[model samples]
Target: MTKAITLRADHGSDDLRRLARASRDAAQTRRLLALAAIYDGASRTEAARIGGVGLQIVRDWVARFNAEGPAGLVDRKAPGKSPRLGPEQRVALVQAVEAGPKPESHGVVRWRLVDLVRWMQDRFGVSVSRQTLGRELRRMGLRKLSARPQDQAQDPEPLEAFKKTFPPSWRRSASSCPRKPLELWWQDEARVGQKNGITRRWARRGTRPRAPHDQRTTWAYIFGAICPAKGKAAGLVMPYANTEAMQAHLTEISAAVEPGAHAVLILDQAGWHMSTHLAVPENITFLPLPPRSPELNPVENIWQYMRENWLSNRVFENYDDIVAHCCDAWNKLLAEPTRITSIGFRTWAHGS
Candidate 1:
């Protein structure tokens, strides 16, 4: 016959009562109640009944409590399998990954899971499963990364030099006077898609009208300058985007700004804006935006509106059609200076 078990008041003081009261979760409350009952001179079976758990679970808890004290009764570490790769093997695996794949022996463009497995087998004479290798890679913080061929061949010197010399600042001289008039100026480029389509509904009940499709054409590039306060704008549509094309666009913008007493031309860090090929005019000052921050440009919102409202649904047959439509949209935007100013000041409101 099995020996009869007796419970004793093992928990010191009234701490278990406080724990039972403080426990919010149902499972935790039950566990604390069971422990409290066991501590209050109840049998294991009696404690299990009060706790609403099995007798075996109560006995297990008591055994754990006796073995490793109160912490042992709370929870134990999960039983998990040990890692296959030893410390030395793990270090070797990291070294192999850092060295990259050997193309001559592996006969592959890049390293794959199977290739890694094979490489490890041949190089270290240790056979490792694909799953094990993947786990090891993950443990070592290795992630899938791609490299472009051009990125490998790029020279950093020219880019560094260009960064250093461009955008030279000139302080206002004491003798210099402000120009004719002051205007809030904005300069930006927009792309026109030559091939575009529009969807329409027909009068017939069951069928929808299909719009014409034009695939051979593309959108014209429009470089525009606008005054927010006066609602006046000047723009030039061109075939391509380059320093020469931008210089031509700037020529037109310079004439417009010539009448303004103060002009601030807000433009992005495009290649044309920073190119050494063009000379910076004295009257017109270029306000360079921080790199890659397109959200700060209000002209972006104008282009977004233009695309969604006017250009999105309509289909154009050729470049000429695209240019005409874009010019019309540009004129319409110029007519609404408040809208432009509101959109431009979006970031400004948020302390950008």
Candidate 2:
């Protein structure tokens, strides 16, 4: 073999000296230590020992340094495989998603992962696994979200405008007199059990058992209110949700408040609440919630509590049964007005 190449001392080279001193990296320090050992007349074995590497590794580093210098010791850029989809293919995929799901794929109505993967193979002639497709979709900032069908007419602007005006309307005295305490009330109709369902099963001394049948029932609305201070709540069940129904609920609520107190009825800007036909007593003013912000209404909490505590898993045989159960739950809410008020006041109290 030819004579083995070795790093001779460049004692006068300021660049090498600066690189040795200024470098703070562990790998660079190790390499410099090995070089220093070699310059000090140590054997390759001793240099490898000082460098905490095998002699072969030390020799490799020495060879790299001789060929490409210190810069060569840094990591090289890793070359990765190209993506399965080209620019045109990715654009096509986005267009298909925007166009919505297609039928004849099956009885399936929605674009599920497996369906999309199959579609990609059929439409683009590009076969990709579900996991890979999911990753690609996410990389393109796509996410699955649910929305109400387009036919549902959701008018939120008036409700929003009312919410903004409500607090100020309540804060200002209905009468110019400053002595009257600020009395606020919320009125709304809550559906009791429109989506209630039940499964009924009967088993005898058993041959093959028959399948259980499901039962469903609908109930009317509960129009109600809560005073923020006393945790006082009162409401009534009505056959229909209309201005007449709302007027009756308001009349009951107005009767309950202390005499001479100005009351503001906080409610959503529903057609009935804003109807010209429905008359309000001079002491009772209406304040509507901001558009699309149902969470801002404290009375909603009472309805939620009722649903969770008494209504969710229970089955009512008829509308009358549901009405009775709702009345009982309403009474329980009335008994704890402080709780109702605490919940109602949360929106304003939290600066929300």
Candidate 3:
């Protein structure tokens, strides 16, 4: 027979009963009341019966209460199975995620959970399930997100430099434009056509929902520009993506600029945009983003928002129908100015 550990003398049976009454945790309250029974001169067997546990468990509880007072009675999270991946393995996994898998070596463009599991087995001789690896990735603060499209020939250095220098450049050019208030506008062109894509839709688990997709090639260009700060937008639906169409679009943008304010238009270095033949308005100045860096333009996001919300999953009857749909979508977008601000605002360009 083991000797019982002496509980702390400061907390008596009355103190424990009072604490038990006040305690919110039901398990903690039960343990406290059982200990109160023991404090009031009840036998350990009687205390065990009060706690609904065996005598050994009662003894264990007494040991814990003696060590840590009422807090010891509280339920603790059970430490489950140990992680299969060690610290060094976790670091390696993070590195692998940051530096995406090579297509030639990994035989896949993207790293899937199964691929990672196989890689872990090959790299460290540890077997982990996809579900477990997913848990680990989530624990590491990694999530699956859609990748942004970038041109193959894009220069990362210039793109980074452009973002860094954009604020100062805007300030300097803003003074030269000689407008009381300068509006920053992001410009881009998207093709809305009969050849429409199917976007994601809500459906029951393990079931695929179908949407209308078109194969016809007829399309029209939407020359779109947005001032995220003011939640202002200008757009033109055009038959072609040429200097004439660009000129028309620029004029429309110029007309749309607020009274007594000049527009500093940021755009990609498209041929139609940079053409010497096209006459730029005095109220608008061109600031071309680095070549092949479409991500720098917020209008890209606007196009994506429009396509996802309104333009996608539809079949157009003809060129006129495409134009009408494009107009309707753009108008719907303009109706919600806050949507424009939310979609197009960039901290790098607009500043806090």
Best by lDDT: 3
Lowest summed lDDT over 10 consecutive residues: which window, candidate 1? Answer: 166-175
Query: For model 3, what is the C-alpha lDDT against the true structure?
Result: 0.91
Clashing pairs in 3: none
- Model 3 per-residue lDDT tens digits across residues 1-352: 7787776898899999999999999998989998899889998889889999998998889888888888999999999988788999999999999899999999998999999999999999999999999999999999998788989988899999989888878767768655378889999999999989788889998998888888999999999999999898999999999999999999999998998898889998889999999899988888999889999898999999999899999999999999999999999999989999999999998656
Candidate 3 vs. true structure, TM-score: 0.89
Ranking by lDDT: 3, 2, 1
Better of 2 and 3 by lDDT: 3
TM-scores, all candidates, are: 0.48, 0.51, 0.89
Per-residue C-alpha lDDT of model 1 across residues 19-96, encoded as one tens digit per residue: 667755665556667777766667777888987778778777666655654555454468897776778878877877
Angstrom error at residue 151, model 3: 1.6
Q: Model 2 TM-score?
A: 0.51
Instruction: Provide the RMSD of all predictions against the true structure, rounded to 1 decimal.
Output: 9.9, 8.6, 2.6
Q: lDDT of each structure?
A: 0.67, 0.72, 0.91
- Backbone collision tally, model 1: 7
